[model samples]
Target: MPLGVGFASPAAGVLAATGALAALRAAGLGAAHSAVEVSVAQAALLTVGQYLAAATADEGAEDEGTEDEERAGPGGPPFTSLDGVRFELETLEADGWQRFWAALGADRRAAARAWRPFQLRYATAVCPLPADLAAATAALPYRHTAALSAECGPTATEVAARPAPESGRAVPWRLTPGGATAGAARPPGPGRGPLDGVTVVEVARRVQGPLAGHVLGLLGARVVRVEPPGGDPLRGVPPMAGPVSARFTALNRHKEVLEADLRSPAGRAAVRGAVAGADVLLHSLAPAKVPALGLDADALTAVRPGLVHVQASGSGAEHGPGLPLGTDYPVQAYSGLAALVTPPGEPVRPSLMTLCDVLGGLVCAQGAVAALEARERTGRAQRVESSLLSAAQLLCRLGGDGSAPSLPVCTDLAELAADPRLAPALERAGCTLVRPPWTFRP
Candidate 1:
């Protein structure tokens, strides 16, 4: 029932929905939350695994630093000047006379530069005429490059392209009887659903945290999204639906929106007040910023005992606490995801989709709901932390060995809404597209 554009969105939706369902069950609302079908959650993870497999194979021939060298390959060459041309030769090899001159053309230089380490490696390793990757590529096409690389050893392209044979259905979520207490013990709210009385305060930006908040809203939590006075930066993203960004609408629908200047005392006080009464506080600020803002898990829980605090980051809290803030692209590079998608001896290329961000959001929602369950059972507050790096690792490890079948891309939302397979769910949800992929049966 999940519906969206891009490779990762649907899977992300399923993960989010599953987490919501789990939380509802833990809250003794399982019966009310049922009536949805659940899709497998590991599809995106397996895709990451496939990419990781390819990257690992690409690394087979080199020392540990090889990937680093490849990533640094582009900036090292300045293609506009004579020195740049000379440097290219030193690192790569040329082919035929005609191809050699053709390689010198600006378009080919641009292509070589764009492709980076792959073309560089091929030029350096396979060119009979030293110092001309453009000529080498011109003389030998990508298919030939793949073949020649294969002759030496298992190529990354071949490894990545190999079919993943494993397949299994996702395990359904379940909750024990007497798991969640009802009435006064539950947070007060207005809905008949499992999470109807739960209140969630979201202090986050962009896709990951907001998406989690969105899922919480879908599950019947009263989610209040706190943005800066100027509003969430995502609101400015293009492809607007009237005054708001469509992307923002999709991720943040059904949540109460509040704009506050956290830099001001009044703003801080407002947020603190909101958190003081909330059952869950979801945030995506840098870890350091959390303590500075006096919104760390300990601080918030002190105000509201048994509160579930979920924090999301690009890397684990300890690894890069002071480093430049992380995002999807840099994490992909750092995590070797970019290298994984590249063919052996080719330039690294990251997936166009924001896989890590989407998965990180899913993991955050899952952790948040699970923590809520734990808090309800134990009378103890919990701090749930998730990171893009951790999400990437999960994807790599949890993905099955078998390759997934190719799916045709949906051209637009209209096409998605029109699909016979999704129409029933859409109608049931009373939304334009399919509802959450999972439905619970009482």
Candidate 2:
């Protein structure tokens, strides 16, 4: 049985499914593992390896000016666009932080004024730090003096706070197996592939949850994507053919789509009916709405017995009391990704693509797969949760590899599909730039 729920981006779902497959292999339930997860892990390792290579280069050199220049590039105003447009700030070193603070305006200043030094430097958009200055302010409380030498201009207005600690041991995913007394039986279906007999009911919108379902479908699960009455809001996003969004098509290719509004009684019944037969139930609804929809882990598992329930959110369920309003962009800013990309004396430049959302989806998928494997062993249902914030933190932990080659950004997926680098994958998937990085051989 496989059930995964997620609420972030397509990437979370993809990763969660991959994670489930990995757990299955680890549990000796199958011989195959998720190629997607392996590919992602390799990429992350390569990045860290590059960082290590750079860090160890000419360690004994007193003045590594060449290396430093190569890492940061020739000192100039930070670039604001892919086309290399630069924004200039006319302020001396002494006035840099003051100008930045003043430019932030009153509300942003009030929110950021109390940040600790490391928090300010890592979390806020005050300014960029010179190498010596960054080293000096490493552990101190944020101070007006430190602000004076900050070189970056005002960017974001929101204050970044550390995520609250989990109240108890944080389980990445949950599993609940059917009791022997409850008549736990293997689902009736021919194994289609690695996830052959698994049936996933995806009651989620946007990228994260749906994407996970999509990956499961690729792996041979029968994934049903439940949408609200009219359809998912993402279906209307631009670059459409007819009424379908290309982005939507890219993320959701093989899954079955259903329309049911959870807000109505009939819709709720429809959803429950779908889940009743499903091995996995995945959703990305806000925590506050779960109980109302009768989709909460405890509620669903009570009826389904051994159902695997997964939830994807912007933040962990316990961290933010009300509805989680986070998305990839905000998570990136809060997680210090913006600062990493921004050059000195410039505004923060977020990646053009939704990096956190993608990663979050993959992680959610991984957790879901792991839970499925646990259920097979324990005959119990499992509750799994993932968030964009957590995904961002994981990405940051990978650190930087300044020595890696600079690759040009691909503006068009169609163009990328034609490139020799991706042509084989594109041909096999029968789609343009829509294949998962790894191949799945039966």
Candidate 3:
């Protein structure tokens, strides 16, 4: 994105405050050890480890290669209609996809050929849909397209052609204390770092959950990442920094790792053991997957009372499960953001930047920090939850009609990093890294 992708820039303040407070409070009270729980949902059906959803997914037929990236292609979606209307299409079911294309008069073979890339577009950042599909839309007006979407299967909406005037942003996160466990006092042992002596267990796949954990780790918490038995798939993504994916390292360089499959009994046992000894757990895996691992909130809090459990979902419960598949692009399409963030009368190009995912992480971190503070004060376990859905609403609210985004827009990550004002907050490298946004004092 052209802008700083800056919401997370402020997350540093929230984490810093809680970490420092925990350190000071622990020093005063004297304690040791802590327990934390993190849950993420990355099921294609709707959710995953919040951490992995925006990052590690390889849902397409194959990873779109670098060659695919440079191709002279329209790339995918937010497709334009025949009557001067640009629109976004969304559907969670393959049947819906098949139905939508058929209704548009696209050839069966071509629509089938397009599905893999369409599904994988978010991960690859490119979707080379067959020309037939594009031509189908071009031949018909947007109203026809919209009507077909309504009648056939997929949801379709006209992308806002102009930026709406800006006005506000919704609260980034929501926190609820589970009183499920008012069970333990804060651990003791005077420690350093704003959150010294605090421990955070992170089980995530991609950007959002991991970034939040990164902030927590920066605040001085002992952050442990739980990977599958094979380690993160992203570790192999190109542009390696040392031996791993530079992008992955940029977000996860400092954390410890524990490889285990939450799907296996041994892996579930391994996670339980880790959470028993940590102060907080932050993750974004699917809810359906949670109980299978025997790591649901009630079960885990049973193991260690007062553990802060944070779930970063694609969309919280408020939006219900029937919504489109929960991922960054779909959320952009569904949340009205694809249309809102563009310049007035410009094509609604949702910034390729991980906009809502980043904001989701920042807001989630703030919520996590607040939960930590509450845990310290009341000796009760707290539930902290946030979602890309909420972040989208928040941005739309804060952005107003979207005519003018507060931060100057930029499409290039490199250029955004190069700006003199943002340069200090970023690290120039193979993969840009956002530095801690605040400096803390004792």
Candidate 2 per-residue lDDT, tens place, 1-442, comes to 1111111223333444564564354335544443434354332321122122222222211132233333432222222222322222222133444455443332333223322221222111223323332222332334332243244533321213222233223343333444322344343233234666777999876566766676666566788889877778766543443445445665676788779988799999888888888878888888788898888867776567777788878776546422223655556655555454444454554443456555666667777777776777666667788876666665555434433445565443344434676343443222232444434433
The C-alpha stretches of model 1 lying farther than 4 A from their native spots are 1-36, 40-184, 187-191, 320-325, 340-346, 399-414, 425-434
Error of 2 at 99 (Å): 28
Q: Cα miss at 85, model 1 (Å)?
A: 18
Ten residues in sequence with the least summed lDDT for candidate 2: 1-10
Q: Cα deviation in Å at residue 386, candidate 3?
A: 0.8
Q: Is candidate 1 or candidate 2 better by TM-score?
A: 2
Q: What is the C-alpha RMSD of each candidate to the true structure, in Å?
A: 13.9, 13.7, 7.8
TM-score of 3: 0.72
Each prediction's total of clashing residue pairs, residues at least 3 apart in sequence or on different chains, is 19, 40, 63
Question: Between prediction 2 and prediction 3, which has the larger lDDT?
Answer: 3
**Which structure is stronger by TM-score: 2 or 3?**
3
Model 3 lDDT per residue over 210-245, tens place: 878876776667899999888988787654555666
The lDDT-based order of candidates, best leading, equals 3, 1, 2
Report the candidate with higher TM-score, 1 versus 3.
Answer: 3
Best candidate, lDDT-wise? Answer: 3
For residues 267-293, write the lDDT of model 1, one tens digit per residue. Answer: 988998998888888998988888889
**Least well predicted 10-residue stretch by lDDT in candidate 1:** 82-91
C-alpha lDDT (0 to 100) for residue 201 of candidate 2: 91
